[model samples]
Target: MSITERLSRGFVIFDGGLGTMLHSRGLSAGVLPETWNITHPEIVTEVHREYVRSGAEVVSANTFGANRLKYGAKAGEFCLENIIRAGICCAKAAVGDTGALVALDVGPLGKVVGWPGGVGFEEAVGYFSETIRIGAEAGADFVLVETMNDIYELKAAVLAAKEACDLPVVATVVFDASGRMMSGSNPAAVVALLEGLGVAALGMNCSLGPEQMKNILPEMQKYASVPVVVQPNAGMPHLEDRKTVYDVSPAEYATHMREMARAGARGLGGCCGTTPEYIRKLVGALEGITPRPITEKKLTMISSATHALVIGEQPLLVGERINPTGKKWIKEALLAGEYSEIAEEGALQADAGADILDVNAGLPGIDEAEALKTIITELQMITKLPLQIDTSDPAAMEAALRVCCGVPLINSVSGKTESLSAILPLAKKYGGVLVGLTLDDDGIPTDVAGRLRVAEKIISEAQKHGIDPKNIVIDPLAMSVCADPDAALTTLKTVATLSASGKRTLLGISNVSFGLPMRDSLNASFFTMALFAGLSVAIVNPNSAELQKAYRAYLALSGLDENFSEYIDFAARRAAGGEAAS
Candidate 1:
């Protein structure tokens, strides 16, 4: 059966290490193993046949390092098209009449992903798009973008596959012994980003063994709504005879694979130091166990490249100072292109316990798109806090989303026709926690029911574009009470109504106290009221002393502070003239 056909049935086993087998046959170290596809097609075919005979249902071709970067068409005798075509042909010949599937193994482009001095986002996308396009033309059933060490590179590859061809793209990243990517993505973070990018399955491979990889399985399972793919090394590597070797035996490795399968792995395989025997042992070991049904976590989440922040974990604080809405310094900084000022503001908010940073660079007579991109990139350099891409322009929103290192927050989409038309596609294409303001072309709703209807309309509209409603955080916007005596009551009622219906809610605390004296005191009470009403996120000035004190107090009183640690830490910071004192 095809891999997709078997996905619903049980675990679909993948072939073990190809480089290991190639080296055993005297393909020397550091000489591109991919060239062996054209040079010694028979050797490549034999290795694939061995895996198929050993019961591997899906065999990745020998095209792991076959990108245009390493083998550019210019001076190379080995072109990417020729190499990948030959590689897939070998795997295809082995799978003939065997009911197995072939996957073109697309590895990293050998550069930093989405970094300043590294490969740019579109350039990386172009490279992977060309390779995946060629792979689909060459008759591969799926694209396996494997051994990723950076989340941005993984996003680039998966986005390329989606834009390039219709093939199912599966991705796996390399996690260090600490259960984080070299770029610092934890398992939860990886799950959030890949699921956002819409990969068929996401996983870990290459760096650690089945035992070490096993320790991270629960975290992946906790957040993963799709199949969790794992291809751990046979064991940890050690130097022997001046060469690297793995320590675990095939039987020992299979034992661990079986344990991982039971714990929520829907796809299992081996990385380095495994031959066909490992697959054979693994296949036999997984005979009677049923695969766990993939869970629908429905979490409202966003992430940096390093960590995931789930909403409803004691109301997230999104720092509101990065935007140029009312901040003259930010406006000046954006116009002057002073990234240092932006970074400093981001750092300060982070120090004051902001869970996410709201980034906006929209100003007249400037390219909002370009400024948003620049500010988002610069802020990430200073902190790993997930960013909220705040802009009224659709172009600015897209530009910021394109370069964001991890899953971010799309600051808004309201009930208006134009807003929904432009923004939902971005949110759907680039995964994020979308904030939907409860307003439309009819303007701000005066009644709680009208606002609730708008939120429902947004949830419905976002769903039409295939956005999970859980990913939509409803903002029953806080209007000034000076304008309407019952405005705060309407917003609070809408927040509580949405919260009761299992919808995540957000509120801008400052909006309620606008045009009022002692606004900080009023904002703190509003914030506490929103918390009691089950707010999920608050866009506020994290540097405000009264607001900080109120938030810490709420957490401590509600038992969300875990033995009052967050509260005690806030008190300690206040004593030290920190944010609470400022």
Candidate 2:
């Protein structure tokens, strides 16, 4: 079966805590290196057999620190290829082709990459390349990059594995007690970066315990398009008899596993101090339980005038009409320095059921940053709908993001290097959500693939800066149908692609109807199409009844409304208030 298929049917159980298991088998950790697989193949194969007997569907080979860099000059003499091959051969022998997969475990190179620590990117990549090539040549089914802290180094490992072989790569990072990597890379940022690199799976391993892993799991799943894997330690380690002991029993470990699985883990296993009994109990606890698939196309975290509307568990329709781009009255008011009109427009959108309001004040002959600040301050006083700070000016975006309470989304960066370089640091500094436009300095792409390429580049760049993909919103530029008949469909395709990348999507919805007759009908139709294509947010006039209706219908149809109670109650309220004119 394909890896996807195996993962889809409940959690894939990987072997647990090899170091401890080896120690239990009378191997001295400080003296006998795991690389002895080349010299003493029988001893390595015994440990593999024990894990297999304990019900491990996948057993990792004993090549964790067998790389040339770790072993130095002895690596060439000891034969790294033979060591890796012997480990995998031992693992396969233990499983006996019972359909078990062998993973070649590659640990860190024990050096920081880029700045401060001095390991250059090219050198880091080279080290991983050699390790991956040796592992692949030894017939390992997958290369497991585990316990990474620095994202730059993780990127190096991923790129190397992709270049070295065709085997799937699973990249995992270890987070410290601070809920961020030792290098300050958070789970969301890790998922965004590694997923963009096309790793087979992304997750946390060898962290605190199931409880801490549970806390990080939701945040990780929020941005992950790929399956999430978790292998928490049995519990915090305690010293007894001059050896580390884990307090959580197999049953207790299984309890945590159930919780992690409920939080949306697709693959579950144990890290340090766990054994086959722990795996058995975990598999048993999850026997009859099926995890609910994450179906939300776009997940968003909102900060409203009253409360934040994070758009994963429910649908959040952020009204995008307060901007003065095409609206003549809005533009005229801004030009006239009439701030009240903009505030009233924002209030009107909230009254018309906007969950969040996107505020923009970009116009000729105006202090964009000052105008944005004034509008945001006034809007906060009038309505509780969260504000999406929409502006091309970094000064303006930063100005709004600083004083804005709660998490706010910045209008965007594009595929262009300058925008990413300039805006991403701001997004990271202020903890701001970002909207990445699917266009570069060369302008928007004309085809779905081109749009996806641009979107991928944006996602990749955002990840490099340690920004969460959950916080990055992708806007595939929506063009007008009067100019190109396929504009709407192409935009939809781009939205779908962005959703599949596990990033939220935003579009200026009314752009599809520009210079066209019966614009409202076109706008509504386009909104519905975008929703069907997984458009999470639309920059459109929320005051329009047709557009609002289209959004409501889309939410109900998407199953986000749950039993249609919200839609029915809304329709009923509109009818009772004589607002059912539509």
Best by TM-score: 1
Which residue pairs clash within candidate 2? 304-386, 305-384
lDDT of 1 at 165: 89
lDDT (CA) per prediction: 0.89, 0.77
300-382 in candidate 1: lDDT tens per residue? 77999899988877699999998788888888887888867887899999988899998877778678888888787788778
Query: Model 2: per-residue lDDT, tens digit, 1-582?
Result: 545567766678788888877777666757545565766678778777877777788888887776767665664536666677777788878878677788888888877665455676567778888878988887788888888876667767887788789888888889886678776666655764565456778898996887777887887887776788888999899999999999889998899889888878887888899988888888888877777684433445555323445554543566777777668998988888898778988888877887778888989899988888778767755665667888888888877765454456678899998898989888775555688888898888899999888888887888898865777778889899999999988889888887776667888888898899999999999888877777777776767878878877877988778898878877887788788635
- What does each candidate score in C-alpha RMSD? 1.8, 12.8
- Please report how far candidate 2 places residue 187 from its true position, in Å: 1.6
Q: Name the weakest run of 10 consecutive residues (lDDT summed) in model 2.
A: 297-306
Candidate 2 at 223: error in angstroms? 2.1
Model 2 residue 41 lDDT score: 70
Q: Which stretches of candidate 1 lie above 4 Å from their native place?
A: 1-5, 73-77, 578-582
Instruction: Estimate TM-scores for all models.
Output: 0.97, 0.56
